[model samples]
Target: MGRIIAVANQKGGVGKTTTAINLSACLAEKKKKVLTIDIDPQGNTTSGLGVDKNMVENTVYELFLEECALKDCIQPSVMENLEIIPSNINLSGAEIELISMENKEYLLKNNLDAIKNDYDFIIIDCPPSLNLLTVNAMVASDTVLVPIQCEYYALEGLSQLMHTIDLIKERLNPKLEIEGVVFTMYDARTNLSSQVVENVKENLNKKIYKTIIPRNVRLAEAPSYGMPVNMYDSRSAGAEAYRFLAEEVIEREDEDAWL
Candidate 1:
């Protein structure tokens, strides 16, 4: 079965969605079957993969909150090895609606179970808040990947996020683990970026990824064209960073395989 991971950060504009999109693309580039679920109401991951919002008949919101089948929402992406379950603005109401349902926390997990064997990985792109949606993602995930930006005060809200993860670990998903911490939007020219990286290296858990995503304009512009950085500009630094991250992930999985 595929391992489910949630790429999440409560802080906004931390390159969470960007990481999710490009990471999925890079993983697929490695010949790994990947399924990305966009649970954010903003649907940036949907558009980032060139999925038209209007054409989406079913979404992760429907699969979780409405008991829709996973197959109903899953759609092929432009990449041969990649697929996506897109979300729309209508997903915003799902959080509130899900609250009143029974076994609400398990909805996402249950939904993913059916499609788990279809891919090597299921990546859930979480919303930029610690709301019911985030809780759902946490409960559903086997591991969590957090993307922290390189900037002053970038650690703000991190305590809250960690506390929530701890709580979830204790009360909900004991099997859930942090996949890694990834540094995004790193500016090599700035001393602060270097400081932030140093702090993260010293303070964070040992699994922090080695690939630091640079503040590349091409990374920012790719989404506007509804494409992943790999497909948009494979030669760009941002794309290469994600590809390197994917290689690391592949190596880690290979190690796990030997175990």
Candidate 2:
């Protein structure tokens, strides 16, 4: 079965979509079959992976509304071995529509289950809120990978995010676990960045990946070109960091398998 991970952080601008895009790309580069699900209505992940979200005929929104099959929603990305279930602005209304539907939380889970064994990893990019879509992502995923930016307010809203995960684990998905925490947009020149890292380490009792993503201009620029940092500029710090993070992810999975 595939290891489904949701890259989630209710706090926006924390590199959640960035991590979701690059990590999935890097994993695919490593010869792993990867699938990315863009649950965020902004469709940033979809566009970041070089898919034209506005042009897609079938999206997760259609899947949720039963207008299309799960397989129909899957589209090939620019990167080999990486597929995506694109989402668009239309998904923004799914929350209200879901409320009236039965087992709304399991809608994503049920669809994903049929395709679980087809890939090695499934990465979900969740929205920046604890809405129904996020709940659906959490319910469908095996673990949640949180991206915390290295800034002054890095720890803000973390507790509530954890609490939401706890509730999902307790009520919806009992097997759900926290994959780990990754530090993003770290600036080595600033003492504040290190301070925030140390603060999160001291406060949060979650596994912290050793690889820290630096704030690189190339990283920021790659998205506009609809390419991952690795594909855009493999030598950039941002690309290297995500590659190391992907190795860490695979290594952790290997260790878990051994355990």
lDDT of 2 at 172: 97
User: Model 1, 1-259: lDDT tens per residue?
Assistant: 7888899999999999999999999999999999999989999999999899767888887787665777888888878899999999989998778767898888888777777888898899999999888888899898889999999877788878888998999999998887888899999999999999898777765477878999999999999998899999999999999999888777765544211
Q: Give the TM-score of candidate 2.
A: 0.97
| Lowest lDDT block of 10, candidate 1 | 250-259
In order, the Cα lDDT scores of the candidates are 0.88, 0.94
- Residue pairs in collision within model 1: none
Maximum-TM-score candidate: 2
| Model 1 residue 96 lDDT score | 75
- Tens digits of per-residue lDDT, candidate 2, 1-259, equal 7999999999999999999999999999999999999999999999999999999999999999999999899999989999999999999998888788999999999999999999999999999999999999999999999999999999999999999999999999999999999999999999999999999999998888888999999999999999999999999999999999999999885644221
* Cα deviation of 26, candidate 2, in Å: 0.2
Best by lDDT: 2
